[model samples]
Target: MTGNTHIVGGIAASLAYAQFTNHDPIIMLAAGVVGALLPDICHTGSKIGRKLPLLAKLVNKLFGHRTFTHSLLFLVMMAAILNAFMPFEAVTAGILVGMVSHYLLDMATKNGIKLLFPIKLTVRLPITTKTGSKVETIVFSALTLLSFYFGYEAFRFYL
Candidate 1:
């Protein structure tokens, strides 16, 4: 998926996590957004990638696209890593939800991610569409709308 789609998915995931856990909505939202972008650090062209090009290039050289970073193993590892520092259940939940959202969004694209990695199985939805295609645009728009609605509700309830 494109950056916009990833961003929308991140925001939506964070909002949902906040609503579900009754944690600090702002912190969850921020963590979720960051977590969503974390996996794409391997791609030199991604927003986060550009910020740390050397690290991104190193990751790409070692793992390549849709390999280690896009796998369930990676998600689990990340959750564990975050859990150590965050300790808080709500923060860990937000991170996991954000990562899952990123994986799911990539699955919806034509070139599905290597979810299982070493297993070499690419899990994708039945509906096949290119990233940033018309279908993706529509999906992104819907996600954006949902994100906005959730944000408004969160603000009304919390602030």
Candidate 2:
């Protein structure tokens, strides 16, 4: 999926969190957006990767794309790291949820992610598509609509 699609997925996750939690929506939304793009930082060609070229190149050379960062191990390690350093439970939840959403979105593609790394198990959805294909374009459009609706619902009062 494209970064734009991942971003919409993040928005959807954040909006869902906002619907249930009493945590600050603004913070959650920001974390969601950032987290969605974080996993792809392994690929230098990726959106966040382009911004942080050195880190992205290092990661790409060290582990290659979609290996460590896209794994469940990474998620657990991230949660632990955030728990130790961030200390903001709600924002942590938002970031994790956003990253999970990114993984699931990637699962919908032909190049499925190794959700469990070092085990060589590539988890994938039965229904899949080529990345950046027509299917992704449609999914992106639909997710965009969902984001707009959720955004309006979540922020309408302030608007």
Candidate 3:
């Protein structure tokens, strides 16, 4: 999936989580966007990668795209790191949700991801689409609608 799709998925997932947990939606949304872009740091051509070229190159060289950075091991490490350094539970929760959303969106792509990492197993849904394809645009649109719904639900108290 493209970065924009991942972003929409992150927003949708984060808003849903905020609504369910009654956390601060604003913080969750911000963290979600950050987490959504984290995995693609392994791809130098990615949005995040472009911003941090040196780090992106190192990560890309060390693990390659859709390998360690997209794996469960990376998620676990992130969870641990966030737990230790992050003072806000909402931020941690949002980031994790966004990261999960990232991989879930990627799972819909033709290339898929190495969800299990060291095991070298590729994981994806039965139905997959090429990145940036018409189907992906449809998925992006659907996710955008979902984000709007979740956002409305999460912020209804303020409405």
Candidate 4:
């Protein structure tokens, strides 16, 4: 998935979380951004990956793509750890929303993510859409529109 998609997913997920939990919109947005980029830390080409290339390389070497990082187990463990050390509601909400966005965005690609990694069961949607293709272009455009709408809504709420 592209960075724009991640940002859109983050915004949408954050907005949804805010609506559900009634937490501060800023906090939920922050969490959503973190969640959306967290999973891609394992991929060298991801946004966060460029910031921490060595760590990304290490993760890639150790686990490879769509294996450990993309698994439900990884998300659960992350949530558990965050819940233990951080504020339960905010952290858990952020992580879950982010992971969900990541999973959904990846699913939009031609080579879908290994959602149930380590189980060797690949779950891909029937629709085939390559990243940066026409489908992706349309999807990203829609996401951008949604993000802008959500951002406007959030601003209105806060202001």
Top-scoring candidate (TM-score): 3
The C-alpha local distance difference test score for the whole of candidate 3 amounts to: 0.93
Model 4 TM-score?
0.90
Which pairs, if any, clash in model 2? none
* Cα lDDT of model 4 by residue, 75-94, tens digit: 88888888888865776687
Q: Write model 3 residue lDDT over 25-136, tens digit each, in one string.
A: 9999999999999999999999899999999999999999999989999999999999999999999999999999999989988888999998888999899999999999
Candidate 2 structure quality by residue, lDDT tens digits, 15-120: 7777788767788888988889999989999999999999999998987888889999999999999889997877887898789989999999888998998678
Best by lDDT: 3
TM-score against truth, every candidate: 0.93, 0.94, 0.98, 0.90
Total backbone clashes of model 4? 0
Worst 10 residues of 2 by lDDT: 16-25
Residue 110 lDDT, candidate 2, scale 0-100: 85
For candidate 2, the lDDT comes to 0.88
After superposing all C-alphas onto the true structure, candidate 1 shows an RMSD in angstroms of: 1.4
Per-candidate local distance difference test = 0.84, 0.88, 0.93, 0.78
Q: Kindly indicate the candidate among 2 and 4 with the higher lDDT.
A: 2
Off by over 4 Å in 3: none
Q: Worst lDDT window (10 residues) for model 1? A: 86-95
Q: How displaced is residue 148 in candidate 3, in Å?
A: 0.7
